[model samples]
Target: MGSPCLKTVGAPSLEELRNSPAFPKSEDFMKGPIAVIECIEEIPCNPCETSCRKGAIVIGDPITNLPRIDFEKCIGCGICVAACPGLAIYIKDYTYSDEEARISFPYEYLPLPQKGDVVQLIGRTGEMVCSGTVIGMQNSRQNDRTTIVTVAYPKNFFDEVISMKRIKNKS
Candidate 1:
């Protein structure tokens, strides 16, 4: 016979999350374009829900089932990148001035790229399709180790560009 030990988990409180940059500010995310989170892992995660800062994503009761992103309030800031532990959260602004759309996601790897840098675009399955540009990158203390990378792509492929990679050239 053995003693039953309690599991220890360090989940962030509602108040401590306020200072997080990934968290928006209020219940005002943005309208137009929908973000699809493909990382489907059930863990103690509220980053996606709290990432919005707009009350857009709601885990509600279970703390899983993927947070429902509210279109209207999403500002397309891509703050969820730093918030999601499974690297599931991303932003898709399909209505980026009608002609073009922007996709923002988390990127943590070697050699951080600067703005205007072109890189290989990847999908949910980790397959490369096209090339994209590094429009923005957010690396703050609050984001922890996650780096927010915003990529600009054609409106047609807005659904394809979830992330980017610099595949060593393979020459």
Candidate 2:
């Protein structure tokens, strides 16, 4: 097994992240929303597995094993999106629109972005990629205070946009 996920301040290398089997195939991704787990190194975590009601995510045996997603079983409900303690899990809907794709990620910050708000989409690194609209937001006790913000952007940016930052004040 590889070393633990303690390198680079928990920021996974995109090259390494793409190597994980958790990424969905083009056909599967274009069909609908699916979970894209970027959990790289082996770590002691399994919230993604337990939160998946469809048994799509499994971190069997060692609790430190990296979580894996069964694209066939994942319904793209975004349940694991907020349950992940490492903030590694994300939801991607390539077919959100004819020209746009939706990307949902866990956000833990005050003054959360509200629906209809335009936010700056950021890449894996902290660089701003493009502007996206806050199409949806999920917050509940079950989410453990982690808000799942869904943003819609150009389909071509599916791989470039992973997270976003609110540029407006809370409503």
Candidate 3:
């Protein structure tokens, strides 16, 4: 019998993210916080659509259709980020400050970083781009096992910093 294909798929590329209709524009970032849907593959899923209390996410009749975000209704609550099974949803706030931006993602790992902890910011391709600080974190029963972590980084790196890596053994 032939072995089953075991190739693993990596995260979406920068080009893909920039080209996706779901990705917000420069003006969209300035309007408070918003969701950046990294989900490109048309998989059978709709948790993100159902999780939005603001009714921001829309996935037509077909369950496999990609989730669409209505920026007008999105409140950047970050709830959809934790609800996505593929871990593809992210929340970004460019208005955090004149020099800094905020990025929130679903975290499901041990030793969660505390507020004020400096961490290495990672890009979509899993590469360390810069250093960021954990400014906020939330984990509630509603979020299930996924912890939402918010990191602050240089405003210029807002588009590059997608995830954060906690520094090990600070001591």
The number of clashing residue pairs in each candidate reads 8, 0, 0
What are the TM-scores, per candidate, against the unseen true structure?
A: 0.71, 0.88, 0.90
Runs in model 2 deviating more than 4 A are 1-10, 166-171
Cand. 1 TM to true fold: 0.71
- The sequence of per-residue lDDT tens digits that candidate 3 reaches over residues 82-165 is 899888899999999989999999888778899998989998667789998899999988999999999889997888888887
User: Which ten contiguous residues of candidate 2 have the minimum total lDDT?
Assistant: 1-10
Model 1: lowest-lDDT 10 consecutive positions: 1-10
Write model 2 residue lDDT over 24-122, tens digit each, in one string: 667878669899988777778888888889999989989987777888888989888888877888899988889999998999887888799889999
| Two-way TM-score contest, 1 vs 3, winner | 3
The regions of model 3 sitting more than 4 angstroms off are: 1-9, 166-171
TM-score between model 2 and native: 0.88
